[model samples]
Each structure stands twice: as C-alpha cells, then as structure tokens.
Target: MANSTTAQALQNITGTIALVGAGKMGGALLTGWLDGGLDAKRVVVIEPAPSAEISALAAEGVALNPRQAATVDTLVIAVKPQSFRDTGAVVKPLVGASALVVSIMAGTTIASVREVFGGAVVRAMPNTPAAIGRGITVAVADDNVSAAQRATADALLRATGSVEWVDDEGLMDAVTAVSGSGPAYIFLLAEELARAGVAAGLPEALSAKLARETVAGAGELLHRSELPASTLRQNVTSPGGTTAAALAVLMGENGLQQIMTRAIAAATARSKELAK
Candidate 1:
C-alpha cells in the first residue's frame, strides 16, 4: 500500500469508480484520487469490513457497499490475492464492458484479470513506501487500453511516487523482486550499519541515529542529483580513503551485488509460483 500522494491523475473521475478494497494501498490510492479532484461521490468502496479510515472517508460522500451491482466506469482490484476468489465473483459483473480494470495485487497476472473480468486491464506493482508518497510503481497494460485509460492509470500510480511502464508482462516479476521488495534492502542496510557501528564501540543510540540519517540523507542526495549511483559512489571514494575501504568490502566478490542478485532471483521465482 502507498503511504502518500503526489501527482494528480484524474481531474474529475467521470463515473462510479468502484474500489474493491480499502486496506492500506487501496486507501492510499483513494485518498490520492479524492485529493486530486475525483469527486468523492463518484467512488464506491467495496470492503466488506471497512477500516476506521475507510469509514471516515464515507462521510465525504463516497459510497460504501451500496449492496447492488451497478455498472461502474472503472473497477480497481486492490484486494488481496487470497480473497480474489470471493471478490471476483462479486465484482466481475458490476463493471461495464467499456470499463478499465486495474489490478495492483502482486502475483495476479493480467491474463488472470482479463479471464475473470474481460476488459481493458492494467496490472501494477507498488511498494509499501507509497504510504508516504515515495514509492515507485511499475505497470503493464493490455493492448486494448485506450490512451486516456493509460493516462488515468499512470496518474493513479504516480500518486505514490514515480511510475515506470514496461511492455513485457514477463518483466513484472523481476520488477516486483526489485522495486516491490527493494525497500527492505535499504532498511536492512541501515539496520546492519547501525549494528556494525555499535560493535565498533559507539553507543547504540548514536549508532542508530547516524546510520538512519546517513542512509536517508544519501537517498535524498541521490534523488536530487543527476549523477548515476555509480558516479555518486565514485565521487565519495578517494584513493585508499575510508569510503573506498568500505566499498572494497561492499563491492567485493561476496558483497552486496552478489547477495542482491540471489535475493532478487529467489523473489522472482516465488512471484512466478504465485502467478500459478
């Protein structure tokens, strides 16, 4: 689920936009849509058990489980993969033939969505950092999606952070392995760094503070800089310098790149299995 919002995708969502889930990612996206000028009245959330946040949103004029299957312009499937068995039967008939089907659930393939819903479909993967509007989403859409529909999808995804599009649905598994699961790696880095610092005699609080801020600051720099990550790394490493010494180990034969490659491969394999 996305943590926050940024870009505005739709000026005015023109019809009843049914959201099948209102958990974190779904809620984050709906918040973005409402904030971006999609009329609150135009939305219908279908969470059987609404969270307090979702319940609060209902007061703003959005419909919560109207109990009848009405044709909607778009049906966004953000519910968990395990719950799709129940939800698909309930949602499939409610969207019109011309409706756009956007699914952000991991491991749920476009083919699966089309088979069940049979409409123009866009499948996307978004990370948890989206809760703060700093996540990245990778999306792939079917050939039938109109330019307008694609734009709408892009706007919706971009509310979290940046968005990337890929033509090959095959790559989405790797995308999921990478960006979808990438945040934990950065977090782990900060965690291990702090642990290492503590091991080197620094106080635990100081070590954690330094590691956290240093990681965050470096990320901000990378975000603001035009230079590639390699270039930035090179700039920080002087000959035989402390940074270079650290890099020597990090970029070693048994270092981050190798470990990351294995981690991503395992994740990709699991994603494919889940697709089945």
Candidate 2:
C-alpha cells in the first residue's frame, strides 16, 4: 500500500490516466494506484497481451484497450525500451496536448519521449523490487512540467516505493546503474555466498537457504535501522571476529568496492549508449 501522501495524491487526480504497458513493472504501478485509493474507473490500460491479472482489472472498471484512443490527462509509458518506438506510435494519440507523461522505461530519454508524445515528460528509473512496493525510484522532469504534474508523477511513482528527484537528467544514467540495477548485484552476492558456503562443506540446499535468509534478514535490518550502513557494519564486527575476518577480505584493496565501482561505471556507460 502507498503512504498517506501518495494515497491522497492518487485520489486527487480527477482526470483519466492511461497506462501503456502491463508487464511486471507496469502492473505493479497499476496495483499500487488502486491500493492507494485511486478510483479504478479513471484508469485505462493498453497492452496487446494482457495477463489474467490485468484482464481481471476490467471487472473493477479499468478500461482495457477501448476500441478508440481518447486524449487522457496522464500517459504512463512502461513498455520495453527496445519496443518503445512502435508502442509510442500507437499510444501517442491517447496523450492530450496538456498531458503529463511519466516513463519508467530505462535507457529511453526525456527528449525522445517528447519527440514522440509531445507532453511534459518525467523520465524515471525504478528497480524490480517495485513489484513488492519496496523499490526506490529516481526521476527527472523536462522543463515544461508544471509543479502539479511533477507532484502527480511523484505520487504515482511513490505508490511502489520511495522516490528521489534530480535536477540534472544526466545523473539518471548513474542512478540507473546504482539503484535501478542494484538488486541484481545483491542477488549475485547471495548466489556467490551460497556457493562459498557449499565449498565450506555445507549441504547445497542448506547453504542456499542460509544465504537467502541471511541476505533477506540483513536487508530488512538495514531498512528498519536508523544507523548508517557503516555503523551497522561496525555493530556486527567484533575485534578479530569471523565477520571482521570476512570484512577484511571484502574490504581489501582489490575487492568488492573496486569491482562494484567498475561494474557501475560499465553499467552507466551502457545506459548512456542506450540513450543515444
């Protein structure tokens, strides 16, 4: 469920909202809006292959691919980056002249969005965790976006998780590398940790279970704790203890930090390339 501010913001939108895709991330956003008290009757979902879950939404009053496209107040583009052009051509007519366009498709630029749809655009990067409403999104809007439009975008994005805004769109590539792709890094960590546990003579199943639970529990702890991550690390590490020994290797000169820096730089570079 969305926070109070997000819920109120969703309830406040009186005009029609059209979601252009119903994949995992798009479906997540639709669920968030409804769960946050937005009226289902006001939404329109445009998807060529709607899942059973998405098809079910029509029963609740959401318009599912109406025979004709009508101008809408907000148009959310959540299609795959590679298919955006074709999808944009189909959905462009649904965007009113004064519509607010919010896109969650990574590597798609605000300039490209405006070129296709010609509305006040907000380009956002939201991670996979959004499916569970625990993601974090970073957004940047084009100059034409009004204060109200920006707020509405905020509320919509916040339905799935926390939101941060940036003045410079250039920062979006790095943001995409960090939080947008960060979950995969954590998942990889758990995967490698499980392998290490297996190498240490633990049963494969037990090692996998331990690694999964440890990563999940630690993430939850970080979520609930007010302390900085560094402080939390210190709290767990005692002098020459097991955790400290592991940290010594992970914190070494050619270790996780260096690897992660290079990884993010590569991802950022790829994002920039994709934007072009």
Candidate 3:
C-alpha cells in the first residue's frame, strides 16, 4: 500500500488504488499514474487471465493480487464489457462504500457498476493513443461521487490525456462516438490522403510518409497554437489556391460535415444499443 505521507498528499482520497484489469487501457492508466508521481507500490493489479500483463505490472513494483481487498480507496475497472459479469463477482468483495470506482469499459453504465460493486461509480471512455499519454477521455459520475473522488479521477486521467466531464450520462454515447472511436476515423483520413497522393503520381512510400507526418504535425500545431481550429484552417486557405480548391469539394453540400454527422450519429446509436 502507499504510505501515509503519499496518501496524505490529497484532501479527499488517501489510500491505495486497485486496478481491476491491467490490459491495454488499464496498463496505460497504470503507466500514467506511475509517471505522474503516484507511488508504484500503491497500485494493486487484479488481472487473472493475462499472466504476461500481470507480470508487467509486477515489474512496475505494484502489488499484484493482494490478499487484502477492502483497503483500496479507488477501484478502477478497465475490463471488456462482455467479461464484466464474471469479473464483477470477483471484484465485489474488494469494494467498500468509501471506495470509488472509475471504469473505462465502453457501454458499461454507472448503474451497472453500482449494481455490481455497490460503490460510487464513474464511467469513462478513453482512446487508444492513451498508451503514449496523447489520448482524450470523457467521464461521468453518479451522485455518490465526492468532490475528492472527482479530483482524484481528474488527476489520474490527466496523466493519459485531457479530461472532460459531462453533466449528463446521456451525452456519453456522443462522446464515445466522437472521441472514443474518433481516432480510427482520423487515421482513415490519413490513409485516404496518402492514397490520393499516390494517385497524383507521388511515390507510394513518400506519399504515405508525407500524409502521416502532415496529419501528425498539424495535430501538434493545433495543440500548441492559441487560435481556434477554424481560424487555423482559414489561415491556410487563400482565395484561389490549391487548398481552397480542395476545401470547396470537402465543404460543399453532401460533403464532410454531413458525412461525419451521420457517422457519429450511427456510432452514438450503436453505443446506446450496447448499453441496453
């Protein structure tokens, strides 16, 4: 467990944290916590199936499968939705009223988490780039959450990326569609851009490299720049330049805006279906 001194660094949360699953997203959160100055030994990982991932967690100096279960202040659940039922029983005994649960399982609602663990629950959806601390995560918690729990969650999540909280759980599905599944959509754009470059007579490798780098660099610029995305885009577009020519097609009727809106709506609906 984390020592008293480390735990006391906060006003609300002041105990060890148990990570229920150390898979990709869970591992990412653990990495963030460790890198963000949380004591490695304070993390207790409870992964049963993947011994390899568990071994990795052990290498981080975290407690693996601790015998004592009820001592955790925060119990984070990052398991897949299909496995939640089986995993719930195993985790139930470890949860206490004082413990807060922050789950990253898609389509797993706070109600489901409370029913299983009977503790304050926060449901979140994070992207894959969180592996390197560049993802975005959106979370929502029930009334059971304390101010301390929310702060603790924000601190932990900020390690991986930016954190945004929604007032209504109903908006989580839109968040899931926009940010949770948004990365793949962006990657698809890069792929198509590269293909278009190749079609325009550029070498395949160079086209791919240029497309990837352009998107990555543009994203970095957006991160650092003070201007809004629309302003930055307008700054690059001229009255009769090549960019404007492309923008005309992209921004025209039956264009990217409508396409993206429909795609996000579809994804949002799927998320709601999964929750049901």
Candidate 4:
C-alpha cells in the first residue's frame, strides 16, 4: 500500500467521482480508493455487468450507476480502446467543465480523450500489478489540465502504486512497451526458467519452486536496494561463476538485449497503430 501522503492527496477529490469501467484496473483503483478512506458515497461506478467484487462495493455505499446522470468533479475512464467509441458519448454528459478527466486506456491519447469528452484530460498507463498496490503508472496531462487537477490525478494513480509524470505524452508508448506490458514478459521469463531447470534434471515441482522463489527474491532485493541493477548484477557474479557463465549467453551479441529491444519496438509500433 502507498503511504498516507497519497491518501491525504486524495482528499481534494471531495466532490463526486465517476468511474466508467469496473474491470481489473478500474476495480483495482476503486479498491485502493476505498481502502484509502475516500468516502464510498462520493464515488459512482458505471459498469454494465457488475462483478461480485463490484456488487460488494455497491453494498459498501459506492453508487453503482444511479439512473439519473449527475455532474461529477472527476471523471475516470478505464474502458478498452475499442469500446471507447461506443461508450464515450454516454459518459461525456456526466463531466462538468471544471472537472478532471483521467483515462487509463492504453494507446488512447489525451487529444483523443479530449475530443470525445472535453475537460482536463490526462493519459495514464498502469500495469496489472495495480491490483495489489504494486503497479507503476506513467501519466501525461494535456494543456487544459490545471496544477490542482494534475495533483488530483497523481493522487488517484498513486493509490494503486508509484506515479510518474511525463511532459511529453508521446513517450507513453515506450512506457506501455516497458512497464505496462513488462509484467507479462517477466512472468514468461519465470516460466522458461522453470522449464530449463526441469530440463537440467531437476524435478518439475522443485524446478518451479526454485524458479518462482529466485525471481521473487531477486525482485524484492532490487526493490530494497539503492544500487543500480547493473551494479547488483555485477555483485552477484563471481569470476568464472555459474551466474557469469549464464550471463555470457544472455549477454551475447544476438541475445537478451536485442530480443528486448525488438520486443519493445514491436509493442511501441502496435501502440501507435492503435492510436490511429
């Protein structure tokens, strides 16, 4: 969980909040808000088919799509890119001119959001780890966004995890390729590591246990350490050690670096394509 600073920052959203999607990321943000002491009565979620978690939230006093549309102080849109075209108009009327509009949809630019729903538009990229309050989000705000509104958006995003503000929205695609999609990449690595361990004669269960723990432990170490990742990697490698032997193959010319670069590039291109 993020500290009280984030919770305190969220207090500025004292009016009404309208969240347009109650799926994973949206649900995670909503959960974080409620856990942080935001008044449940002040929030309204616009979900077509409510999940059990959403039903529970509604029971807790967070409004689940009241019939009459009311103006909100903050409008948060977390719908899929394709669904935006169909749902955007319905949500536009719910926002007041002074309200803050933050979109967590990937590949949806601030200009695009502003075109559909006019307000202080912010574009954010948040990863799935947000469900557990460990995600990292990068956000960019349009010129229409005020300093106060930007801070409000920052507070909302930080409820889920760390928040980074970027001056250039164009860099969001790179952010998407790295952090937004990076968790899946790490999970794939863990899977392959376990398989390789099994191939080396270790039992399947033992291999899986070793792989999961190694990756989890390394991530925790990295999180706690002030040292750069490269420095930490060097610290783990002894002269002619097993780690060094593994690094030789991984650091080879046509190796992890090249593979990662190509992967990010492909992801960035697809993100650009989606914007079109």
The candidate that achieves the highest TM-score relative to the unseen native structure = 2
Q: Please list the C-alpha lDDT of all candidates, in the order they appear.
A: 0.85, 0.93, 0.84, 0.90
Clashing pairs in 3: none
Of 3 and 4, the candidate ahead on TM-score is 4
Q: Tell me the tens digit of each residue's lDDT in model 1 across 23-129.
A: 99998888877766677888899998888988998789889975643788788888998787678888887877779999998999998888887789999999988
The C-alpha stretches of model 4 lying farther than 4 A from their native spots are none
Error at 30, model 1, angstroms: 1.2
Could you give candidate 2's per-residue lDDT for residues 138-185 as a string of tens digits?
Answer: 999999999999999999999999999999999999999999999999
Return the number of clashes found in candidate 3. Answer: 0
Candidate 1 lDDT: 0.85
Candidate 2 regions exceeding 4 Å error are none
Quote each prediction's TM-score.
0.93, 0.98, 0.92, 0.97
Candidate order by TM-score, decreasing, is 2, 4, 1, 3
Q: What's the distance in Å from true for residue 145, model 4?
A: 0.4
Q: Looking at model 1, which ten-residue stretch has the lowest summed lDDT? A: 1-10
On a 0 to 1 TM-score scale, where does candidate 1 land against the true structure?
0.93
Query: Considering lDDT, which of the candidate structures 2 and 3 is the better prediction for this target?
Result: 2
